[model samples]
Target: MTDTAPSESTAPQHDALLADLTTIRVGGPAHTLLRPATEQELIVTMRDVWQRGDEWLLIGGGSNMVISDEGFDGTVIHIATRGIQLVSQTDTTLSLRVQAGESWDGLVAKLVSRGWAGLEALSGIPGSVGAAPIQNIGAYGQEVASVLDGIDFLDYDNSEFVHLTTAELELGYRNSVIKEGRAGVVLAVYFTLTASPESTVQYQQLATALGVNIGDGVPVQQVRDTVLALRASKAMVLDPNEPDSASCGSFFTNPIVPEHIARALPADAPRWVVDDEPVADVVVPLGETPAPPPPPKPRLVKLSAAWLIENSGVNKGFRLPGSRAAVSTKHSLAIVNRTGADAAEIAELARYIGACVLSRYGIHLQPEPVAVGVELA
Candidate 1:
């Protein structure tokens, strides 16, 4: 796809470069940019682009992407549609159907203000609601996978609108079926939130910050405030004046490895048990009570990528020779564009970090963002 004249769209302009759209501010120009204001209009645009056999990309807030300096040689669709409707409400439960284009943090703030408790822990996260489920976005031990109930999307194979349930989405830790490169375009997302004044503090750090124990309930608004403050301290929140905020959040996800591999790492390395192998249940004869099973052994472990990077001797604010990219000063896991860093510099820095971790601990850290044309070779 080459640059062409502006086509009919809700928001159409000349060749808008990806650098101007992405949060990191590094990518090259895109062939074309299209923003649709309504679901019907977005569908029509998708169909038009497909029928014409043009390469296309769907961009939301552009928070979790790394495009190459060579730019994307395709049409870019920006989901600019916006609306939120309370689909259902009960004495204890409330359901919201939000447009994919709505800002994620904005939605969380709105819900928390109304005493909804499910998304308070996810406050201050960047990107759009439509992009949430694709990555099963999570923070502070609260994942969108828990609150997300359903999604309405334009199916890639038939160009027809389809609604899928949470189970069908197959959400996992920062992943879902959509991440497999499916062509479904999320038009809206349905979330079921608890109509409660308080939310459970599942994460240890968050609990400690709130002066509470794990599993304790804290006011929803307080949780949101605490989460935002925590994010700001790490420079994870977007701030134009803060150079460390110019990043794609955490560069690498916490690596989930087998228990044995995690045990091989240093004892000081932070780790969390993800899951354990199921133990066999005790069977009983008819009308008899069944016995409890023994404690299961942990089989999966979530290792801290940040710990690995720091322990590998890469300090915060580390940069390659003559490169504009560096690790965020406040957070070891983030890769920031220090001085108008291009995609190459970012990729180089990421490669160096990964190599360091691998050489030190034999664990290859993988990047979390979706790289368009740039790759960490």
Candidate 2:
């Protein structure tokens, strides 16, 4: 593919693409914006956006992203590319390939309805399937990486297709090469799903809520439903009317500390083994674990970011003594738009909540949104 400059329009239509595209109703416009309906068009348009020396921001469902109020300076390519093909299937397994533009939740919904078990625990995360591996999106004790078999990407530096393995993705807590660096746009993803109804109920809260136990198999659809319900309760699922769900999912990855530090917390601090390997020895909860009771190690145990924020005195629907935005009334971790809000306002509010958490817990909270053009710092 080659670059081609878009027809000139000075009205900033390029940037307006995000006005309604993302969950946060904030952000400026891209100097140029294009939505490629197909891979070919996406590539061609992207080539032009790139070769023109124009800076670019690639957006998908815009759910998990937070753009700056100032907006993107270069071109913005909103990938609407689509396709979800079950290229092959077997009695106890399936080989599915999904284009980057496919809605992540929509696909999971379909798979669940079909009795597919692999992704049931990750049902409600907002964003496109392509963006899933970008941050190794996870929830309800499951992450996308567990089912990811291969990834197809457009390597930005080389401008070519690259297939990567799970190892190459370097999956970590809400982090991957794509989320951390300028990895090229994902084209499609290939997943090898199991045929048997194998699943891990690693999250204790979810199991208890579902009245199931860890390692006990449940219908994939049930898992999906339960997960989505749990997420909605936490304001993690996207809902137009729910202000808390308007922001990114979890605002921070659970902090994993050394065992000694984790053990230093009070007897009630939550602790769990991260791995079964004898060498594996780190466990701390961000405090989202349900039904486990308040972990004894509020200080030594990694407190739930939500718990810390609330306990630090920032209650739901909290606003600065004088501010427009507020914390979600339903979820403490989310900085929300109680009314019409702007990016700058959100950033300021986030900083306030973060400062309060730091002051009280001495733990720095990191945002989960892929902040762009905006400085949360």
RMSD of each: 4.1, 8.2
Candidate lDDT scores, in order, read 0.88, 0.75
Best by lDDT: 1
**Candidate 1 RMSD to the correct structure:** 4.1
List, residue by residue over 243-307, the lDDT tens digit for candidate 1. 88889999998999889899998899899888865565666899987766655665889999999
How many backbone overlaps does candidate 2 show?
A: 14
Backbone clashes in model 1 = 0
Q: Per-residue lDDT for 154 in model 1?
A: 86
Q: What is the lDDT of residue 352 in candidate 2?
A: 82
Residue 187 error, candidate 2, Å:
0.7
The lowest-lDDT stretch of 10 consecutive residues in candidate 1 is 1-10
Cα RMSD (Å) between model 2 and the true structure? 8.2
Candidates in order, TM-scores: namely: 0.93, 0.87
Query: Which candidate gets the maximum TM-score versus the true structure?
Result: 1
Worst 10 residues of 2 by lDDT: 3-12
Superposed model 1: Cα runs more than 4 Å off? 1-12, 284-298
**True-structure lDDT of candidate 1:** 0.88
